[model samples]
Target: MENPFGAQTDSESGSAKSYALMTARGPQNCIESLHHPRPRAATRAGRSGVQSDYGSSKNLETKTPNSCPRKPTRFLTALSWQYPNEGVIKINTDGCRKGEDGHITARGVLRDSSGQWMRGFAVNLGIGQVLEVELWGIYLGLKIAWDIGCSSAVVLESDSATAVHLLNKNVEHFHPLATMLWGCQDYINKNWVCSIHHVYRECNMVADKVAELSSCLELGLSTFQDPSDSIRSFLSEGLLGVCRP
Candidate 1:
C-alpha cells in the first residue's frame, strides 16, 4: 500500500509506520513518564523579531512544544452532569481541607441573570474530612438560595462527586456535614424547585479555585461581602456559557 501523503509504497512490507501526532490532556502535571517534550525551541533567527512571548510559531514552539495546551476543561467538567438550562437558577459550591495543620474551609458563590453576583461566603470549618468540607459548601449555597429567594432552581452542582452523592442519598445518619442535609432538605421542602448534580472540578472550576483559596491565609478570608478572587478564574474559563435562563 502507498501513503498518498508521501512517496512510501510498500505493499508487501511486514511492519507499518504511523505518523499521527498525539497531544497530552488533563492537568498540566498529569502526564508522566513522557519526557519533557517542549515544542521546537526558538531558532536564533526566529527569536530576533518577536516582541511578545508568543508572537510567532517558533516562539510558541520554544515555549510549550510538547505541552498539551487545550482550552481550560471546564466545559468537560460541566458536561459531566448532563445538566441543562431552562428558566432555572444554578449554583456552584466548593470545599477544601488541609492535611498538615488540620485546617478546613468551605466557600460558596452564587449568581443570577445579568452576570450579577448573588452571594459569596466562607466558613471556618475547623478540622474535617474533604468530603465533609465539600458537603458544607453545597449546604451553604442552598441556604443562600433560600435567603435570596431564588425560585425554581434546577441544579445544585459540586466538584466533588463523593460529597454530591452523600448529599442526594438515603443516609442513615449525618456525617460531619449532617446538619447541611437538614438545611438542604428544609429548603427543598419549602421550595421543592431544585435538584442536585455532580460537576467535575474542570466544570466546577470557580468553586474548586475558591475552595483551594481557603489555605491561603495571606489572601485573607472574606464573607458574602467579599468573595475570594477564585470566581474570576471560572468566568475567564467560560463555564457560564450554558448558564440557566
Candidate 2:
C-alpha cells in the first residue's frame, strides 16, 4: 500500500509526483470572508474533491454599495516553535485528510518548558472535512491536557488559521460544526488558563508527522508517552530553535 503521508509518490509512468502545501490567507481575511455575505458565482473545483461555490465578487459585481477597496499587504516571515513558560505546557496539534481515500486523522503533542514531550495522541477520525478534523485535534489536545492535570497553564497551537479564528469568534449555533466548536470552547472556558494561537505548518511538523502515523495504525485514538522515532528528529530541530521559511 502507498504511504498516505509521504511527500512524494511514484507515478505509473516512472515519474515522481510531489505534493505542495497550500498557504491560506491570514486570520483577518479568513474571518471577514466567513462572516460577510458575498455574491456567489458558478461552482468550481476545490481541494480534496470538494466542490466550492464561492467565487470572486470582483467578477460577479463591479463594486458593492459604499465599499472601499484596499490593497492587502504581503510580507515574509519565518516561524518556529517556542517552548512554553515555566510550569506551562505547550500543545501542538494538526489534522489532515487523504485526498484519494478521504481518511481523516488528527494528532496532538504536548511539551513542557524544557521542550520535553509530555504526551502525544493520534486519532483516526474515519472521514471528515479539513476544518472539522482541525477542531477535533484541538478538542482532543485540550482533553488530554486536562486529564493529565496540566490544565493550569497550557498553550495550544494549530496550523489551521480558520480553526483558530472560529474558536476566537462567536460561532453561530446553526453552523455545521457548532457542537464540536462548543466542546472546544467548554474546555477553554474552564477554570484553567488555556490560550490558542495559529502557527504555520512548519512549526507544527511534529504533530503533523504524528497524525500521519494514523494512516498505518489501527482505527481509533492512540496515545504516546514517548516521541516516536519518526518525529524525534523534528522535535530535536525545534529544540535547537531552527526556523522554517
Candidate 3:
C-alpha cells in the first residue's frame, strides 16, 4: 500500500538497512533521530512565523500609537498688500492658469516704496504647469529688476506658496523648474538684499492684473516701460490704505 504521508519505499528502506548495518559502530542516539525530523518549538507568534518576539521590545509599543491620525484645521487671516521700506522695492508676481491643460501666463510688477510702478512684464508661456509659470515670473522679474539697476533690498512677493517654499530652501532639485529657480537664486546672491515672500491672491491684485493681460495679449513677452492706462489705474487703486483682518 502506498503511504500518503510518504513512508519510506522498499528501495529506500533497503538502502537505509544496508547503510545502518555498515554504520553499526556509530552511536545509537545519533542513528535513531536521523530517520524522523524533530517538530519545531511552538512560538508565541503562532502560525504567523515569528520574526523576533515583539513582547521583548520595551519601547516598541510606546513608539506607535493605536489611534488613527486626524487632519489639522487651517484658518485664513485677511491680509492687505503693502509697499516695501525706504530705498526698497517690492516685486509682485503671479501666474495665471485656465486649467490643467490650458495655457499659462506669467506677469510681475516692480514698485518703489511709494507704490509707484517702476517696471512690469507679461509673458505668454503658451501652455505649462502652474509652478513653472510661477517660477518663470520670478526669474524674469529678477532679470528685469537687475537690468533696471534696482539691486538693493528688493522684496519679491508671489501668491504661489510652492514657489516661495522652493525659493526659501535655496537648494537645487530635480524639479522641472529647478533651472529657473537657480537663476533666481543667482540673482538674489548678487543683490545686496533679496527676499522672496508669499501673499494671498486678494492682496496681489496688481500682479494678477498683469498676469491677466498675458492671457489676452498676442505677444510672447511684453516689457512695460510705462504700464497701459488700465494697468496704471489698477496699480493706483491698489495703492490705497491697506485693508486689515
Candidate 4:
C-alpha cells in the first residue's frame, strides 16, 4: 500500500522514500525509510482562519490572501520533550487513527517538573475525525490533571498542529465537533493555569506509541498511574533529552 503521510513510494521496487536526519552537530543525510499512515480530513475550522474561544478574535472576514502575512519558512530541527517549570506539570497528548480499519484512539501522559510520570490515559474513541480525536485527548488530559489536584499549572503538548490551532481559534457553532470543542474549553476556563502548545511528532513519540496501544486493548478509557513497560524506553529518552528527526 502507498504511504499515507505523503512519503513517495516506489511502486516497482516497493521501496519507501528516505528522510534526512538532523543532529546537534549538523545535518546527517542518513537514508532511513519511514512510513506514516494517513489521517482523517480536517473540519471547517481547520480550513478557515476563525477566532477561537480561548484567544483574541481576529476579523478574518475582511482579510484576503494578499493581506495575510507570509508564513515563516520551517527548517529541519531535532526535537525532544522538555521538562516543565518548577511546580508545573506537563501533559503530552496524541491521537492515532489506524489506516487499515480507521480505528481512532487518543492518549496522554502527564509528567512533573522533574520528568517523572504522574498519570497517563488512553481512550478508544471508535470512529471520529482527526481533529475531534485530538481534542478528546486534550480534554481528557486536562481532566486528569484537575482530578489529581494539579494546583500550580499545566502545559499540554500535542503533535497535531491543526488540533492546537483549532483550540486557539473559535470553532463555528454549527461545526460537528463544536460541542467537543466546548468541552475542552470548559477545562481551559477553569480557575487554574493551563496552556496548550503544538510540538513536532518526534517530541511526542511517547504519547503516539501509547495511542497506538488502544488497538489491542478493550474499548473505553484506560488510566495508568505507573509507566507501562512498552513506553518506559520512550519516557526514559525524554528525560535523557534524546533528540529525534
On lDDT, the leading prediction is 2
lDDT of each: 0.48, 0.66, 0.61, 0.65
Clashing pairs in model 1, backbone N/Cα/C closer than 3 A: 1-11, 38-65, 39-65, 77-203
The TM-score of predicted model 4 comes to 0.69
Sort by TM-score, best first: 2, 4, 3, 1
Per-candidate TM-scores read: 0.56, 0.69, 0.64, 0.69
Clashing pairs in 2: none
lDDT of 1 by residue, 127-222 (tens): 556776676576567766765667655456676767655544444442444444444544444544566666555556556666665654311123
Candidate 2's TM-score: 0.69
- How far off is model 4, as Cα RMSD? 16.9
Tell me how far the alpha carbon of residue 55 in candidate 4 is from the true structure, in angstroms, after superposition: 20
List clash counts for every candidate, in order: 4, 0, 0, 4
Please, what are the lDDT tens digits per residue for candidate 4 over residues 118-236? Answer: 87776665655677679878877888788778966777888777777766665676565666666566576667777777777787888988887677644455676677677889989
Candidate 2, residues 1-245: lDDT per residue as tens digits? 53333322212111001101111332222223333232222112230111211111121223434554573444445566787789989899999899676778788999999999887776666656789889878978888788778857777888888887777666676677766676677677667677787777877879988877777744455566677567889999889877765
lDDT at position 179, candidate 3? 54
Q: What shift in Å separates residue 74 of candidate 1 from its native position after superposition?
A: 20
Compared to the true structure, candidate 1 yields what TM-score? 0.56
